[model samples]
Target: MPTITIKNIPEELYEALKSTAENHHRSINSEVIIRLEQALLPRLKTPKDKLTNIQRLRAQISPNVISADDIDDIINNGRA
Candidate 1:
């Protein structure tokens, strides 16, 4: 195993990292390693993963469906 030292980390960033590590029940070093891996290692998403992510994001949105008529009314009346 190799050891590394990081210097001059901003106070706010350190605090945020510390808070996140505590929330996840991880040590600061482990949190840094996890974060570094996430930033440096890119993984290809499978079709199912992509669909799941899209569905998850869509679920957060309001269910209001806008129609063409509604769009025309908004454009003409300058109202949402």
Candidate 2:
């Protein structure tokens, strides 16, 4: 394993990180690694990915739903 030093961390931020690390049962070093990974990781979602999500959601919905006008009226009424 490699070692890295992070310098000039603000007092408030350091305390928050220390608190979070203790709560998660991780050392400060481990907490920093976990937080860095979460911040750096990129989530890729294509159109196909979105389509699959839409299909899944649609499948769970019942047929013979209310008309668009009815939905619009309901939305407009909510603003009043």
Candidate 3:
């Protein structure tokens, strides 16, 4: 196996990672490996597919004024 060394990591980020590892009952190395796997995993999506979906959704909604508060409420409540 090839050895990897990470350099110049911020102290605050290191502390956060150590805390997260402790919370999940995992070693720092294990936690970092899991995080790296998640970050590097390929997401399946074509640019055309994403644009088509966005356009279709936009067509369904009226081009009316929407408030920031309304958007926040929708996100927080996860409902209409």
Please, what is the whole-model Cα lDDT of each candidate in the order they appear?
0.95, 0.94, 0.92
User: Which residue pairs of candidate 3 clash?
Assistant: none
Rank candidates by TM-score, best first.
1, 2, 3
- The digit string of per-residue lDDT tens for model 1 on 1-80 reads 99999999999999999999999999999999999999999788999999999999999988758888988998989853
Better candidate number, 1 or 2, judged by lDDT: 1
Q: Give the Cα-based TM-score of candidate 1 against the true structure.
A: 0.60
Greater lDDT among 1 and 3 belongs to 1
- Checking candidate 1 for backbone clashes, the offending pairs are none
Worst 10 residues of 2 by lDDT: 36-45
Error of 3 at 35 (Å): 0.2
Q: Pick the candidate with the highest TM-score.
A: 1
- Scanning candidate 1 in windows of ten residues, the lowest lDDT window is 71-80
Question: What TM-scores do the predictions have?
Answer: 0.60, 0.51, 0.51
Candidate 3 error regions (>4 Å): 42-80
